[model samples]
Target: MNFKYVSYLWDEAKAKSLGNNQVDLLIYRSNLLGADLRLTNYGGGNTSCKTTEKHPLTNEPTEVMWVKGSGGDLGTLKKSGLAALYMDRLLDLKKIYRGLQYEDEMVELFNHCIYDLNSKAPSIDTPLHAFLPFKHIDHLHPDAVIAIAASKDGKAINQELFEGKLGWVDWQRPGFDLGLKLADCLAQNPDIKGIILGQHGLFTWGDEAYSSYLNTLEVIEKASEYLASNEGKRRPVFGGVKIQALEKEQRLTQASKLAPILRGLCSSYQQMVGHFTDDERVLQFVNSNDLDKLAPLGTSCPDHFLRTKIRPLVLELAPDEDITDYKKIKEKLIPAFEEYRKGYTAYYEQCKHPNSPKIRDTNPVVILWKGVGMFTFAKDKQTARVASEFYINAINVMRGAEAISEYISLALQEAFNIEYWLLEEAKLQRMPKEKPLSRKVALITGSAGGIGKAIAKKFVQEGACVVLCDNDADRLKGAEEEFEKTYGKDSFSSNVVDVTDNQSIAKLYQTACLAFGGVDIIVNSAGISISRTIEETKESEWDLMYDILVKGQFLISQQGVEILRKQGLGGDIVNIVSKNALVSGPNNAGYGSAKAAQLHLSRLLAAELGKDKIRVNSVNPDAVIADSKIWAGAWAEGRAKAYGVTVEELPKFYASRTLLNEIILPEDIANGVFACVGGLLNKSTGNVINVDGGLAAAFVR
Candidate 1:
């Protein structure tokens, strides 16, 4: 069959290479299936296989069910992530089942069924995967199949689309009960290869891993073809588009202005990072006539709404107004967000369980604007990006459902129940605590340089999203690639910026806004130095030093402040100053004076911006010899000449002069910067930290 929507990536040789290890083949099948979002979204769905393993205690072959554990993504799953439980013990859970009220209790009981004290917790759908008769099983939320599942006539459609080979089960919140019903459905239609769970997703199974994977592909492919065939008809989607999307540049430009405002308002309850997109499907949905009608219905898939929340808050401007008018958009977003909060609180009041987790973060995770795009805000960058993707999956479900029949949203009560489920609350409690800078976004100028790169890496390690800005495009690209491999593409973004130029600085902040909502930290580490005597300092040399060290920092800070105030989130600004700024040094007239200017500027800004809660601090380091760009050229030779020492002995000379006799390094400078903003110094600002191995003269008075 010619497959249009999904890619069949199964390699026969690769499957054979796994040999006879059942769990290994299951993992292979899982990775292949999960490589495409068409099969399942990130961290969505679960796969399982029944295997015979020698018991850790008894040393006897035992039937252990190995299923994808809670919070594990199929694409990245390993043996450690699979929960192993005794089959007989898991099935024995049925004997004591006291009905739906005790469903959550069943999850707790699953702990008692572990085969060999496996630490990975089983998902709530453990019964669904465990009780299934097949040795291998696949459960996925493929957009094509979910569209059919979320349709008004999903059950009848599922049977018709796959003929007698596929069976249907009504939507029941996934639990021990739903698991029992799924098994019953298959039992009733013994010849069917899979069952479509209404308003949920697809389930396919076979005796082996390869067969199960193929069965899943077969089901989703058929659904895609069916949806594709109908999409060719006129007015096939949401009653056709009422407004065409803006040009790509116009859309993102408007998004940049709109994103910070939305991020700020949504972050009132808690800080959030943001993501933006204008994919074709998103534009088709948001710009449609039926958007107003369809949007409030909410997403149907459990996994979709889990991250995106039940319904997205739709935002749009009047036809008469200009989308580029940032001021006007800001005015609209504030009250709309307030109203959204009120509605959300009311939703809680209406449907909340008596023991529900305290109404979590009333902020809407997903926000939609007509003719613009979708913006999602979450605690961190990856979560924000994943939430956007999930909502897009929701849009796909909506499209397929609406094209063939009326889309059926899950009942608000069910959405509420799932959102407030105790099991989910426990899961959240188990999550590791947020790192120091987790939700913060920091923009570090001269990030390709040693000290700047160290600061950027530290911030990312502490969980802040960083924007790496520098005039050197090649170095900036290399820095981003290095960060991408380690911290991932979301942890940092790179921009080629000449900090001395006002327009260049402006665009850099704009990129920060579009990339990660708004800036929470500003690091002005870009620098240059000339170690010439006052008499030898040329006019051009002095001007160049001041341009980069003084004017450059001012312009970058000016732009960053605008965004910080817009976000209404207090921010941090760390200026990389020099010990020369404090202690007078010979042959350093230009460099020393410029450093003094940057040092004083930080203090002045701290005093003036106190009301705005923007803290400004300086990290003064005398000799950051290791990995520092400032020490790589003429400055080293010139300083060495002034000290009457060889360039190679400069580090020792500086270290010997200090009371502690310790050599200063770039990472030490980075540590000082992080100390200023890493929650430890929230109440302290305008202070200068001397990272020159205890140099008395450079210490702030």
Candidate 2:
């Protein structure tokens, strides 16, 4: 039971809680093993159990296999996510089996074996689980185990460590043929608990769930111990660090600046969101003397290479260059990135089969910068983050393999075959279409209040990350809590920002840059309302309203344009003006005048920024009384008195006056802004969208 590298986390009480339900026990065991990154990368491993089930027709017992379904993570596998196949039906497929070249066709045959009518689709590894003669099995991509499997003398290393307690199979891409070879290996060596897949991963099994889980951990632990004693405490790895890493804060600052440039370059074909990491291991690899030699050799594990792409683009520098110099990095990165695309294009041309999927975006998924860390870009944040994670797993595998013997990677042709496999392409083709704001990020002032909060929610639902800004610290904190509760934590970042203050606005943009690389949409929604005749209105009141209503838009737009220009990605600026901007109303001098000015400013920005490919538009919302911070105070009484109605009668009064007899809510205003900035208006700028239930007097001419 001695453990060093990976922890043993099987709780007896927890396992016993599942009782006699073997399927529940299977899930419990799978989650425990998948808990550690050392055991498996996210969505990179499989687990299964074979149990007796009622035959659908006979009401008699039949053996069935429950394997983790295709495209699911082991740690989060649910009953619905498990692919259930009748074991007899799956085994019967060998009757019609052709040779290895016909293996992919086996996937089509797998559908016929489904034990449950609505079972999740089986993974290619379904055969790996089905053909093995064990009740419970775990197939994992543990870095320690893959390290040995990916070593120069991997088979001999298994013999050295397991001493023939485990079987060995040379690298064959997982499919029906590899599954058959696994069964043959187990039959030849009946005493072995599992098989080591050359340059791939490990498979271990037992008759019971916990036992199989323990056996999987046992094998990985021993491999980890062997590497630790020999390499963990020994000489420096990757030929020792060559370029020393910058101090923590400096590297992060550099990363903040570099991510947007990379994001911009990669977004030529499609928009991209980015994730950054500076893990100690990543730093060691990027700064190592052997990085240039080892990195381009590519990753060995399919799980690793598939997410990270075959290899990474490593940033180069002369010994005299300072890694912290952002100016120098900005100049060099584009050419280096271009060379990677050319290399990738040539790789595709060299290895593509007739039916191969057309070469994709060609941009590198994982980028390695010496003395910095790693940056990965993808269509969404989670994918980008996961890509970064998979590369770290690749780094670990290389480290472990190099520790005991020379590390080995997949052959380029073989890697190409797996990466561009038509089956894999079909999965990509099956993905849902991108949401309108899929890769966009927005920054909103007054986001803690009614219309602004609603707009932030709508943007997130449409797949945009948002930065929620408000000047009121308490309200912003409360709004942040609501946002986290409503949309999980990663949907947005929040900061206390005063739009009227230029210095405050500058720091807000920095927060946006640090949190999400940069912003794509800027919404000016902060406002205060007052209903006063010229005699009652103070000079200070007019200045305050303009500062918040008009100048807030101006300041936020000015700061946000800097980021948008830096990204070279055209963006959106939505000004939330008011119907009062168009309608002449009594006792509304200051509020009306400022909104009119705001509307004009939107048109002016649109005309000015069109050359920059930035679109500017305004949404005019009328009588937005419900849940409005402005309406909750004296503004409500003032407006109600102007209409000769009590504050209590205001909602009905406003509704009756609108042409459609409908009262506007915060969400309605949010929709108007969306209509202006969403792809529907991609070619239109300097436009006004009215969400006021048809206010004739407020209509834009």
Candidate 3:
């Protein structure tokens, strides 16, 4: 809302218009907006501008819009940082809204205007911009406006305050219909300067860039002023309901019921919104009368559905209720949620048109009526931030509108119609997947020696940041030093991790995500050996082997896959399996079973993650002597002694047993990991690649 910053950005964006194909401006705007986004946390909005110019070589005119892509906030939008969008096509598609079927047709229509083939789908609200009559548009759900929107009669209240100053639309399901509605509104009010989408957000425009940008501040200030001067009688009768008085027991009960479903839908929402209740102002607001009415305004924008789903939780508290029974309270709340889900299903079925996609889940985005405040869910930090902002603003806007008349929601069926509407779903399902990580971050576990170290080095050679993790801290440190000295680039990092511990694995992934933005490739090369027959293998040894191989792989893969889902980039995970997994190995029940479990886990993950563009596969290597720590250890050494051969001769003995008599090095296994990157084997996930030196007849079964 700062005029100076807006002016500065407008000038800079105008200045950066001379180049063909540059991401600098897009990145700059993303950071600028990102700051505002982080501060407001949930109501952070974005902007984009379209321009058409003649190509220098072809003499043909192409269009591009400077869009605010992922990864940056809007409070600090800079020129050269917005995503360059093809403009003419966007404009062309903007005019074609006829005869489109639901999901499939919608997805097919979205393909008409393509931006970066390397990034995820364009923002869900891109369609909003597609129909904007203006070249430059700024959208936001500032807290000042949202606080008013949260009221029970938000629509009526906002209408009275703005009173002919802004164009208002009841919250339409924000897609093609919203765009068409906006286009109609613009047509009616040739002089209609700005638009305020009820229960949704604010859209500002300009003939000259600054006019629209400045208008946003001007209109928001007007609404803020109206609320300031006419806030009505200060109802302090509920002042006795202090933060401590808002049952600590009831709060936990509500969180438990809502967290899992919300978490499953969008994993990061609980963490972000939970922090607000800790603040005194938010807690006081929740304790006040406004709490009950404002809890169900939904999100400030439709896209918020992606993060927080649709609604937040509402909890009803009685003055004398014993607040100490948290667990008992949660037990009772489950049935209420079940009832809500049932009601929701009926609503969806009744209201949805024949052209909508089937509902994906029964969970409500928001919780209500149980003495608990709202909770938003999201897949990542950014999504959660957006959800919280939208929730906060919608509440404020609802409150402001309540002074005039009753607030109206689109009929449940209509909402269901919009939510499950095929066109809307197709936008998400048909998005083209990209592989930027063919050159991004690579994480190699057990990278001190063998295939792990090779993969780690391979990533470094191919323009990627590498993290080397292993149980042997010293060797990992050594590899780190060698990487730093050899390349003299600070592109390699190391972590000493015991992957068997769930907590440790979680922390390791957190570290990886924080340090390198995100992890794109994960190679599990850490394993253990007992080398005893089933009866001879001690219980303790069997436990240790399973812990290192099966449990370690499970935890590591889980953590890695979660982070990859959030990064919005194509991700790859490679498991190091033994040929023994495919063919039974003698005296190796525990090890074989554990490895087989790992292979199966990889396959399952591949299926689950294919939608997320994450690939999971394993390399099955046989008789590789390059980094055979098992052979150097007690069991293999003892076996060598018993066979009357030195430890060095063990390599020859294993190689001669193979059909080709060839020795495979750790580097060979590393190459298999590298192949998974760059999208080279994109279509080949779930299958195990044989990286053995050719041993057929001797294969144990």
lDDT of 2 at 527: 85
| Local accuracy of candidate 1 as per-residue lDDT tens digits, 1-701 | 45678888888999898899998998888888888899999999999999998888889988999999999999988888899899989989999999988888888899999975654788898999988889999999999998998988887887778887988888889999999998898888899999888899989999999889888998899899898888737454888788878888788777776677778888988899998888888998999988998999999999999999998998857423464555667787778888888988998899997789999898899998888888899998899999999999999998888877778999999999988888889999989999999999999999986999999999999989999988888888889889999989889877899988987876787788788988999999998888898889999999999999999999999988878877778899999998989989899888898999999999999998989899999999878878767688889999899999999999999889999999887888889999999998899989999888987777777
Residue 489, model 1: Cα distance from true site in angstroms: 1.8
lDDT of 3 by residue, 113-145 (tens): 665444334554566776776766777765455
- Model 3 lDDT at residue 45: 61
Query: What is the C-alpha lDDT profile of model 2 across 1-701, one tens digit per residue?
Result: 66787878888998888897888988888888778889998898899999999998999999999999999887777888899999999999999999898989999999999999878889999999999989999999988888999999888989979989999999989899999999999999999988999989999999999889889988998998888777744457888978888888778767766667777777878888777888998999999988998998999999888888998988774423443444456577779878989999999999999999989989988988788888888877778788888899889889989888889899989999999998999888988988888999888888897999999999999989899999889998988999889886768888898889998887787667666767799999998999998889999999999999888889899978767876788999999998999999999999999999999999999999998899999999988887688899999999988889999999899899888999889999988888877799899999999998888888888
Q: Count clashes in each candidate, considering only residues at least 3 apart in sequence or on different chains.
A: 0, 0, 72
Error of 1 at 28 (Å): 1.2
The order of the candidates by lDDT, greatest first, is 1, 2, 3
TM-score leader: 1
What TM-score, computed on C-alpha atoms, does each candidate reach?
0.98, 0.94, 0.53
TM match of model 2 to true structure: 0.94
What is the alpha-carbon lDDT for the whole of candidate 2? 0.87
Poorest stretch of ten by lDDT in candidate 1: 318-327
Q: How far is candidate 2 from the true structure (C-alpha RMSD, Å)?
A: 2.6
Candidate 2: how many backbone clashes? Answer: 0
